[model samples]
Target chain A: MRLDLFAMALAVGLATWAFRYGPTRLNLSNMAPDSLLNRFLNATGPAAIATLFVASVLPYLEQAGGHEIPLALGTLAVLGGFAWRRSVVIATLCGAVVFGLASALV
Target chain B: MSAPADAPVTATPQPMGFRDGLTAALPIIVGYFPIAFSFGVSATRAGLTGGEAVMLSVVIYAGAAQFLALALVTSGAPLLVSAVTLIAMNLRHLLYGPALLRRAGKEASTRQAWAWAFGLTDEVFGAALGALARGKRFSEPMMFGLGLGAYAAWVSGTAVGALAGGGALAAYPALDAGLGFMLPALFLALLLSVLSRVQIPTIAVAAVATIAGTVWIDGTAGILCGMVAGALTGVLRRPHAS
Candidate 1:
């Protein structure tokens, strides 16, 4: 019940909510198909994913001294699993299994 | 992994309903539980009470930023400074809703956007885009279901982990490492699911920009750099119909 923690949570929560909530309220449905905005929006999905992918993976890679082989094989397993089954759950599970086994064995 | 310029939109997809969204959210729920658990452990270990740990998940709901907030607060940083820094780190989220709706096109309803948008976390946003790529029509109920499921898992996981205290997860070291890979694996799967040949250059640009930015400045800057770089690359290479 620290007042500072409460205030920080309230402020961060409100601001974060605003960030998540503000853009959806926009009426971007009427934009031209080839408009710059449309193009940017279309690309945002892949771009965002790629950005997150790199951001998420980098830390592990940076710290991957003893876990290098496991990490590499796990990544390949994820890719292969998705290619074979087209299921994110299956792919991620496969990756985790491979990573966990490899880590245990290595 | 296929090289088709676009994923085939097989038909007028049925608008996803609540059940469908919940089903789709299962993986995210799984992915979130361990991370949230880790966060709960970390928050408590850092001196916050179990209630406060759960409160952060319930309120802030930003995954990594909560960790950052813990460090800042525990280090006696000013409250406003900590809040501002966390918000700044998450500015990339501002693009998710608009970008999602744009891909949904004019046919999608936004009548409940104000309510559902609160659930639009990074994974939720990516999953929604993946649904669109699969030709599913957007429904507010589905978004609600998806967001709610993930949110519930996160909060519940945190509460359980907090109650269990810090040493709860330390016993399963290998499991802990594997769980750390879930978020990246999830994102990679989502990216590959919707990937197209036309977007390759944009992905490359984003990946390179993100790496460089991370190396030079910070992770947040890297994300922004990648997004802007990839978006511009996409616009530049997009074909004109007229």
Candidate 2:
């Protein structure tokens, strides 16, 4: 293993640790008001939807590849699952399974 | 001097329990698995060892940014350049932290907040926020479950990808190609769910603006431009009523 890669990983882990664990120790969560919290919650859903659109759709249309059918089918399954069950886990599993099966067939 | 010293402390209503948090976070975990798998595949292609790839997943943890950083580092970019570029890419986390602080505060301590901040990916933030919107109290165990599940999936996916890339590549050549489409497809599904008339147009404008900017300035600048455009659109559209 390259020493540099190891060093980089260690640095990143430490940084992440500090970021994830530090604020709680400092009690910063108590500082925010209820109105602010409400706003944050409201914003998250839209942002998530936005992110999903970008991450999933843009690359597929922009990049040509053989896996398009499976990708489409898998996505459809996920969407269907979400509609039917309103369950994220089910939707995701459906997508993954469809992708895997389609890949195997092709 | 005048306030009552023995005012009763009202108990905050707990949101869904740890089970619900884990359930809610499942989508993110699923979404991250393939992305992390791709990262491992790329790492091996970039000539890193298996141990190195796993380490990357465990340590760096920022999927898209880490992949971009790895490419830059491998291309012989200066360490300073890579570092600065990465920080810029991840600056969105600053917004994430402050937002999360608002909702999960009553149950979260400074240490817990820091931990949550570390785990604050786009997906986790979304899940937490979604839960709260439904009037759920943001619980620590739920957040931990979500974070831990994502972490495990990422690390495990990387390991699987690394192994496949090393020797299994010959048997499962299509695995790599198939994995490539997962992100775009996933994103599309997400977009479809979120795209209202106002938001879709705004996103399109932002995407086009970013693409155009990339043609001129290049690199991560496009992402920033896109974000700014989206933020402006969001602010402008806020008064129209949802």
Candidate 3:
């Protein structure tokens, strides 16, 4: 069940306090270094993120997409720009222009 | 000679004062505006009132998750599904917490950890952990500053986009079409940027599983399945620590 915003805030506050000075404590220093679980959890971040992005786009990709080529190329350019420039706003804007132009062509 | 190549480095990192952190967050703040503005514009067009749009941004405070929720809400998806989707999407945060907490070590106070958790978005984690991985010290205050900067940009951008672009965007069909790819493009960028910190084999497994799963399953569930499959592969591969 979802907690109301206020209740959620309160729970977080309590948890923070408990972790700070309560009998039950967390030792974050050496928290399961290089353990199996830790490694699995760690790998999941990128795995999940990548998978999620792909999944988000797959619905459109699976269909007989009308503007598939443009969308694919535009997204690729966006990723390239992001990796090269390391800025989301600029990369997307540039890619949007390409996407717009490519859509017009086909 | 850069201060003698073999000179002993300081054992502890100097505290990253607020100024440094804010400076670091500047790009992120600037980068967030357009996306948040786009979100605001879309939210209003999707039938949410301007106030509702702004409130959702403030309360949700999740980048992509907020969009997913908006889509689900507009489509009349069940509440449970929306909540589950968001949680599944954010499970990656679990991975971020350990890496960050480990870096923060004993220096992280409970108050600091709570605040950190509150503001730990993927971009923030990427920025902060990327720094830590590069040998810079992990300072909670710096992270807090970065979080605040990003948060302000997001909330304010939502307000502007909702109020300004909300009504105007209805006339621009081309704009909406272009904006449709924004999230996907963004995710692709993020995936690329984070690749350095991940193993190649893990990514391969994730990619194959995600692509295969999406063709079979639907929506966020496909991605979740891909994640599980990837993590299972990680177990088999014995996990590659960054």
Candidate 4:
């Protein structure tokens, strides 16, 4: 293993380690409902998660690759499966099947 | 909190432990396998050995960052560039902690809290939050068990992908190509699931902000911008709540 990779992981571990002191329901109880910090986190919370996932995957989308049709069809199948069933297993299986068939032909 | 009118006063139930966590983590384990497998395939394609690919999954455990690192390695970017970009990419995780801690319902001592933070990947955070919304009680043991199960799947999957890169799957071009879609599909699943539990307004705002950001900026920058826009909308929409 490269020293830098290990170091990077360790840094992430330590950075999150500091979050033990972050505000939680227990501490927030003492504050007002609309307290400045509390309000900020709440609003940021859902958005952070949504944007985070998008940002993480967008890079992969930008990578140079071909065969967009199969990828798209399979992805849509997965999303549609999820919307219908709300089950990861079913959606992934559906996507895999779509992806496999598309890949075979395309 | 008080019991309902018809309930008995003493209703202490079985405490959630490692076993419960293992069960809860099963879905995540199943979900992680294909992505980790893809990562393993990519890493080996980038000239990393099986051990190296598996090591990244074992130690780094950051999915996007590892993929980025493979890009860096393939392009021969400096090590510092890899490290800095990774830290920047994962910075959003800081937001997950406090929000998840609140949803998980109990405060931990510093030690247990740190362990929870260490295991707090995006999928795990989504699962933990979804579990809360579904009314499942949270416990430290359960959380750790969930993390461990997912961790094991990722590491082993990486190993399998890397070591088996030259095997039957690769021999079939279509099979190898199809597996590449695994991570994105998994992400889509998590996104849809999490959106289901969030308030409608928050979801709409987040969706709009993300779309605008993606069009206006690069991927990482767009994500940060979208998050800020979504947060601003959330704040404007609601004066209180987190």
Q: Comparing chain B with the reference, what is the TM-score for each candidate? A: 0.70, 0.69, 0.75, 0.71
DockQ of each: 0.45, 0.22, 0.34, 0.37
Ranking by lDDT, best first? 1, 3, 4, 2
Higher-scoring candidate on DockQ, 1 or 2: 1
Residue-level lDDT of model 1, residues B1-242, one tens digit each, is 12265867554656888988998899889877866876787788788899999999998997756766775677666677667656655665777887898888877788888888888887898788898888888899999999999999999989987897866657887776675566677668768865888889889999999999989987666766887798789889847532
Which digits, one per residue and each the tens of the lDDT, describe model 4 over residues A1-106? 6666566556644544343224332354455656666455555545655555555456546767655677788879988898787776557657867887887887
Per-chain TM-score of chain A in candidate 2 equals: 0.54
Interface RMSD of 2: 5.8
Report the CA-based lDDT of candidate 4 relative to the real structure: 0.64
In model 1, pairs of residues that clash are none
In angstroms, give how far residue B235 of model 3 lies from its true place.
3.7
Better of 1 and 4 by DockQ: 1
How far off is each candidate at the interface, as Cα RMSD in Å?
4.7, 5.8, 5.6, 4.8
Ranking by TM-score: 3, 4, 1, 2
The full ranking of all candidates by DockQ, starting with the best, is 1, 4, 3, 2
Q: Fraction of the real A/B interface contacts present in each candidate?
A: 0.65, 0.19, 0.40, 0.38
Candidate 2 chain B least-lDDT 10 residues = B181-190
Off by over 4 Å in 4: A9-66, A85-97, B1-13, B106-111, B166-168, B186-242
lDDT: which is higher, 1 or 2? 1
DockQ of model 2 vs. true complex: 0.22
Q: Which stretches of candidate 2 lie above 4 Å from their native place?
A: A1-106, B1-35, B70-85, B95-101, B104-111, B130-136, B186-202, B213-242
